[model samples]
Every structure is written in C-alpha cells, then in structure tokens.
Target chain A: MGDVVLASLLLPLAGAVAAAVAPARRTVAVVTAAGQTVLAVVLAVTVLRDGPVATAPGGWEPPLGIALRVDGVAAAVGLLAAVVVTAVLAHACASPASTGPATEPAAGRSAYWPLTLLTLAGLQAVLVAADLFTTYVALELLTLGAVALVALGGRGAYGPALRYLCLAVLGSFAFLVAVALVYARTGTLTLDLAAAALPPGPALTTALGLATVGLLVKSALFPLHAWLPDAHAAAPTAVSPLLSALVVKGSFVVLLRVWTALGGDAALASVLAVLATGAVAWGGVLALRAAALKRVVAYSTVAQVGYLVLLLPLVTPALAGGDGVAVDVARTAWQGVLLVLLAHGLAKAAMFLAAGTLVGVAGSGRVADLGGTAARAPVVVTAYALAGVCLAGLPPSLGFVGKWALLDAALTGGRWWVVAVLLGGGLLTAAATARVLAATLREPGPGDGPPPGTPHGREEAPGATALPTPRAGERWPALALALLAVVTCVGSAWLADLVLVGAPPGVGG
Target chain B: MSTAEVYLVLGGVVTLLGAVRLLTTRDRLAQVIALNVTGTGTVLVLVALAATGGGEPDPVLHALALTGIVITVSVTGLALVLVRRLDREDDGG
Candidate 1:
C-alpha cells in the first residue's frame, strides 16, 4: 500500500523529468499517464477492500514527519485525476493544436508534456498529503503548473495566467498563515491530530475562516471567481480540460478536508450556501450570455462549482438534529457531492475537448460560427451533446443520480433553499447548454462553408484558416469520456458504498 | 509588551499593508512585490510565534517558517518569470 502511494507520486515526477530531456517526450508522457491510471485504480481498490491505507514516509511518524493517507475521498478523487489526465493526454498527443506549427517554436510543446506530468504529480501529492503544510506545498506545485499551462495559449493567455498566479499565491499565503496559527495552537501539522487537539476559540475560528477563504479563492467559488473564466478559456485547448476538470478540484478537496475537520459549523455552512447560490445564478447567466463557445464552457465551470459547495451546508450536523436523519443527510450529501464531482470532471473534460475541436476546425470561437459543425464533425458534435446531458443533470446519467441524491437529502431535511437551487440550477444548466445545441443543429448558411467532412476540406468562412484533417484520434477520446459520464450511472450504488469506507463521525450509516 | 508580542503586532501591520497594496495595484511588478511583502509578513508572524515556548524556540514552528520562506521565494521567482514573459509580449505586440 505504501509502495502504491509512493510510486503514484514518484512515477509522474520521474516521467516529467524524462519527458523534459527525452527526444520522444510524447511516448514518455503516454506511458506515464497509463501507468498512473493503473496505480490509481489499484490504490482505490486496495482502500475499498482493506480499509484506509496510510504511510509515513522516511520511517517517521506524525508530529515529527508527514504521512500520506488514502482514505475513501482520496481514492475517489485520485482515480478521477488519473482518468481525466489520461483522456486529455490522449487528445493532446494527437492534436498539433496543443503544440505550435512546425515553422513556429517547439518550446511550448516541449514544456507541455513535462508541466502536465508535474501537475499530475502535484495532484497525486495533494490527494495523499495528510498534513496541512504539505497540502500547501503540493497545491503550490499544482497552481504553478496550471498557471504555465494557461500561458501556453500565447499572448492572449498571459494576462489571465498572471492574474491567476497573483490571486492563487495570495490565497496560498493566507492558507499558510492559517497553518502557522494552527501549529502555534496545536504543535502538530497532521490534520486529524490537529482537529482532535484544537480547542474552540477565537484563534481556532480565525484559522478555520482563513483556510476557508484561501481555498475558496483557489477553487474559484463565486465572488472570488474573477480569474477563472478568462484563464480557463484562454488556456491551450488541451490544457483547458485539465484545468477545468481537475485543477480547480484539488483546492476544493483541501477545502473539504478543512470543513470535515471542523464538522461543518452551521454559521460557516450557511454563509457558503448563500455564496453558492450566487455562483449558480451568476455563472449560469454569464454562460448563457457568453458568445464564445469556450467562454460558455468556462462560465459553466463557475456555476458547477456552486453545486459542489452545496455539500457543505447539507452535511452540517446541525441539520441532522436529533432523529439521526441529519447523519443520513450528511452521508447522502457526501456521496452526492462526490458523484457530482466525478460526473462533472468527465463531462466537462469531454465538453472542453470537443469545444476545442470545434473551435479549431471552424477557425472561430463564436457560437454562431458552429452552425455547420455537425456536418463537418459529427462525432465531436455528438460528444459535446452527450456531455451536455450530464451537465444539465439529464436522466440515466451520473449527473442525474448525483443531483437526485442531493435533492432527496435536501427535501428530506426540508432545506427548501437548497432544493430550489438544485431544481432551478438544473433548468439554467439545460437552458445554457441548449443554446449551443441549437446552434450546432442549425442548417449551414452561406458563410458556414462546407457541409461534409471531406478528407481535405478547409473552412473557407471569413477570417478562417485551413486546419489539418480532423483525425479519429482527436474525436474518439471526447466521445469515450462523454459516454463514460452517461454510462457510469450503473456504478452509482457501488460508488455510494465506496465513499463510506472511511466515513467521518456522524456522516455514514 | 513582550518581544514576541511586539513582533506579532508589527507583522500584522505589515501584512495588512501588503494585502492592501496587492489589492489596489494594477502594475504587474508591484503586485508581485506586494505578494512577497505579504508573505514576509506572514513569515514574521510565524517567527514570533516560534518563541512562545519560553527560553527555547519550537523547532517545528521554526521549520514551518523556513518552509514558508522557501515557498514564497520560489513563487516570487515564478511570478517574475511570468512578468518578464508578459513584458516580452508587450514589446513584440
């Protein structure tokens, strides 16, 4: 088990190094992503079968040395990171759109493989990091890698990337202060240990508040989401999926840790619930209004993030009251959030990858220009539509299952506001997605260029340029992921069971 | 007041100033510098707290402070690199 944890971390770091220096960087990256996926599955299975797996690196125990622990949350999210990274890498490996043209510099291309692997390493590290300070470091690695990936979009991306870095670093520093204060009070960096030892007071409350604020910034949850849409939309096509699907989730998981440790303070949870409501409404409206395909997808991310935060308010033990119903609500909320997270990751990756393909082929980012996309790239269009089903929480998809769980819990608990948000947010999501679907299904107008996927067809629409023939390699992965999002509903029962393996006190049945 | 309390107050004031500058400034380089200042302020607070154990400093707090500094420096380096890249884009475009 320890070896699994250690290898998961080191394998990617080592692959990152080799990819940086090796001539066959693509080969190295593909192999590493596949290997990491295997490791994640093994780790998840090991934890599910034998309970939680933890390791103390360098033979040192807690309070002296850091430990890497893989409980149910880590296993579920670790598997997510592996699967999403592999799918995006598969797409990137085949698409020259990720790298520059042959005449241009290869620097971005070379940097792409190594940085992505490093980001994966950071993700793995954060999942297993049992200490707050170590989480800070792992998150720094992830943030820096993600910032660079955004900049790979070239000049347009630089400003957003810089803004992302500045804000993210500020958030990290705030979190560090919280960690420092926690240490000053408790003398231990191990999270569970600190949580057990921490006494309620002004200082502890302040530490918790700081940690929440810091992580919320990183996760781009509403009011603090100023940097996200631009950064995600401006990132390289391949990088955008990874950023939206996985990067934001890392900080979110950390926030989950902090909240679970605090056992969901009612006041904090209520505040978060209000902010989440704002995000869903604001983000959904912006997504609806956004003209560019990628920005629409990006804004949808901001909205989806709100649903993730709804978990906190529902999970608060106060809601459970005395009938043991609150405990069941907390348990249901936890499972619902994780399922929503998994569904969103897979679906969002498919949407972005398909969006990139559409944008690339159309030679424009505008939704109006995608009118003929179905004729030109039917597979990509299908992928995008399938992803939309999950995004809108349509039936027989994992998104529906997750949202149903959330709705059931909210209705049972009589959390009317949460119920309103869930139902209303679903309508908004469906409406937002329908705009793109409507455009794609429209008949090709005069400016819409060619109607068929000719082997060598070029988009002759105004301001458009010739692109490489759309390859099967680029189109299939998006469909595969989108299909996975819909098909995984079959496993919802199993997933609900798996998430309870190391359930927190008062959380699971 | 004790020396530790004095340092803690100073650190708080400095952090507040840096945070204000970080929020108000639009200049890229200034923003980076402001972030560094804020991080230094945090380190200062950590250092002051390291002495709370009487005559001997808490080794763990000191270690955390050091780790904080290392992280701040690297992030600063990365921010500067980004600033320079942006500068090149400005010149070329």
Candidate 2:
C-alpha cells in the first residue's frame, strides 16, 4: 500500500519528464495525460477501498522524514482532478492544431503541457502531504506551475499572470516565515510533531495567524482576489478548468489538515467562518455583475470557496455548540463541504470547457456578444445551462444537494445568518447565470451578425473545422462531466459512509 | 534578550520590510528584487532557528527552505519574461 502511494506520486512526475522529452507533440500530450489519469484513478480507488494510505519517502518516520497520507477527502479530490485533466487534454487533442499568424508562440505551447503535468504532480503531492514542510513545497510547486500556465494566455494575459505570481510568491513567503517560527519554537516542522511538541503559546498563535493569512491570499477568498478575474479570464481555456476548480482547493485542503492536526481550535475557526460568510456574499455580488463569461465563472469560484471555508468553523462541535447536537451539525457540515467541493470541481470544469468551446466558435467571450449563440451551438448551450443549474444550486442537481446539506448544518448549529448568506449567494448566482442564458437565447438582431470586423470569412477556411464546434464529438466531454456532477449527488449516502470509515464511531455525527 | 532571539527579531523585521517594499514598489523589477530579499530573509531566519538547536534542526524547515528557493527562482524567471512581454506589447504597433 505504501509502495502504491509512493508510485502514485512518482508515476505522474516520470510521465511528465517523458512527455517533455518526447519529440512528437500529439504522442507526448496524449500519453502523458492518459498515463497520469489512469494512475490517479487507480490510486483513488486504492485509497477508497483501503483507508488513508501513508508512507515515508525512505525508511525514516515523523519529524525526521517526510510522510504522505491520503484520506477519503484527498482521494475524492484526486479523482475529480484526474477527470478534469483528462477531459481538457482530450479536448485539446481533438481541437485544431493552433498554427496561425496570431497563435501563441511555439515556446509557450512547448511550456504548457509539461507545466500542466507538473501541476498535477504538485496537486497530488499536496493532497497526500503529512508534514507542513512537504505541504509548503507542494504548494510552491503548484504556484510556479500555475503561474506559468496563466502566462500562457499570451499578450492579453501577461499582466494578470504577473500579478498572480507576485501575490502567490508573497503568500508563500508569509507561509514560510510562519513555518520557520513554528520550527523555532517547537523544534519540529511536521504538523503532528509540532502539535505534540509545542504547547499553546504566542509562537503558535503567530504561526497560525501568518499561515491563515497566507492561505487566505492564495485562496483569493475576498479582498485579496485582486488577481483572480484577470488571471482566470485570460488564461488558455483549457487551463482555466484546472486553475479554478483544483489548484485553489489544494491550499484550502492543506489548511484543513493543519487545523485538524493541531487538535482544532474554536476562536481561529470562527474568524475563518466570518471571513467565509463575507466571501460568499461579496463573491456572488461581483460574479453577478461581471460582463465577460469567464469573469463570471471566476467570481463564482470565490463564492464556492467561501462555502468550503465555512466548513472550518462548523467542523468542531465546540464551535458549533453542545455534545450530540454539535457533533451532528459538524458532521453534516463536513459532508456538505466535501459534496460542494466535488460538485463544484466537476461543474466548474465543465462550464469552463463549454465556455471555451463557445468562445472558440464565436471568437469572443463578451456576454453581450453571445446573443443568438444557442441557435448556432445548441449542444454547447445545453451543456452550459446544465453547468449553470449546478452552479446555481438548483434542485435535483449536486449543487442543490450540497447546498441543502450546508443549510441543514447551518440551521442545526443555530447559524441562521450563514444560511441566509448561502441562500442569497445562490439566488445571485442564478440571476447572473440567467443573464447570460437570456443573452444567448435572444434572436439575432440586425447588428448581431457576427460582431463587426470578426473574421467570419476566415472561419470558413478548409482547416477551420478543426476549431471546436458544438457538434457531437466536442459536446460529449463537457456534457459528460456536467452529468457526472449531477449524478454524484445520488451517491451521497455512499460518500457519507466512506467519509466516516476510520472516524471514531459516532464521534463524527 | 538572548543573541539568537535578537537575531530572529532582526530577521523578522527585515522580512517584513522586504515584503512591504515588494507590495508597494511600482517598478516590476524592483518588486522582484524585494521578493528575493524577502525570501533570503526567510532563509536566514530558518537557518538561525536550526543553529539554535533548541529542539534539533527541523528537517521540515530545511525542506520548506529548499522548496521556497526553487519557487522564488521560478517565479523570478517568469516575472522577467512577463515584464519583457509587456514591454514588447507596448513597443508593437
């Protein structure tokens, strides 16, 4: 089992190297992506069938050696990431070879695939990291790879990517400083060891505060979200899914692990909850007001992440309230958070891919310019609509299921204000989605003939068909992921069982 | 305060100063330099902690320092490229 866990991290990294060295573009991209996906799926299954898997790189243990451990949450997220990466790579494979006067430089294309694979490796490393130092390394890997991917959007994207790079580096620095302080006081860097070694003191408090602020910046929770819209909106469409859906969640997962390993605290948790509530409201309002399709989805990410942060406060029974009641509320909150993460990962990726295809066809991402898009690309439109429903937390979808669970937890915890925020955020998301849908459904007015000066004539060229069409082949991947998001809700009972497998009996709920 | 404590305090102040400079600087290159300085300060602080041997040099801190170095280098490289790209875009017709 340890060997399997180690192999899970190593194989993708090896595949990434092979992909880089492979001369053929098509072979390297396809093989690397497929190999990583298969490895991820197999490992996820192994983690699910067995329990959390842990291993030291060599034979050392604890404070001396690094350990990687994966629980049910990590496995689920790993599986979701694998699915998203596979879908995006498949879409890239099918799309036209992007050789044009305006295509991104060859150097940029060369850098993209390798960095993407590296990013996947980093994410996997993060999911399983059992020590603070290893987790920090994994996060740095993720940030570097992500910054590179963001810059691949070419001229229009460089500014945003640079901004993101700066903010991410600063966050990493802050986190590193905190890790140093913790090490200085506790004499150990492993989270479990630190928890054992250090008593509650000023050093610990400072460490936690610094680390929390760094994560808040990296997660782009609210006020620190200055870089997200531009970075997400301008990145290559294929890149957006991974960035918005997977990378940010990686940091949040680490934060959870840190809190858990530290035996969990109430005051810090409440601070996080209050911030989360603010994020939900702020992100939703901003998302509703965005004019670009990608920007809207990016803002929606802010809202969804707030929901995940809410789990931090609600996870501890003491934070929620008294014995049985608090326990039940916390359990519900955990399940809600997990479900939301799963659903949002699938739905958001699908939505981005669908938007990518639509933008490819229309040659624009302006929401207003998308008028009559549903007429020309009904399948893509349908995919987008389904994704939107999931985003809005409409009934019968996974979003709805997750939100319902969240509300139940909120209500049970006597946190009526959080419940109100969740509902309002959902309604705002619905309205924003409707705005896009309405635009797309509108009839083509006299001025709606493929926005002035668009290269409509060029689109009719022989090789132009290679550009994504809403036709059957291009539609299935997005539709399938979107459907998976909806279907996962039905598997809630099984997921709940899995989440509680190793948990102390009756302690969880 | 002990010598080690004084050194740690100085390192922390330097790190914070570098961070503030990085955030407030208008020139991209200057910001990158400030970021590098901040990273160096962090490393110095970690090394100081290791030297004290109060608990034994934490391997986790070593790993974090190594990772931070790699990330800082990569980001600096990328930032240079972005700055060049911005300049080119501006110069282009």
lDDT of 1 at A173: 82
Query: Could you estimate the TM-score for every candidate?
Result: 0.95, 0.93
Give me the displacement of residue A313 in model 1, in angstroms: 1.3
Model 2 agreement with the true structure over A1-509: per-residue lDDT tens digits: 78767776876677678767777755676676676677666766676687777778898875667888877777777777778877777765555322111356877776666777888888988888877777888898898888888888887888888888888888887788887787777767677678778777777777877887898788888777778888988887778888998999888887766665554567787777788888888888888888788898899898888888888777755432358887787778777777888889999988887877676666567777777778788888888888888888887788888889889999988999878888888898888888878888988566553444433212334444333345455677788888888887788666665555444222362
- The DockQ figures for the candidates are 0.72, 0.69
Residue A19 CA error for candidate 2 (Å)?
Answer: 1.8
lDDT of 1 at A223: 93
Tell me how many residue pairs clash in candidate 2.
Answer: 0
lDDT of each: 0.85, 0.76
How closely does chain A match the true chain A in each prediction, as TM-score?
Answer: 0.95, 0.92
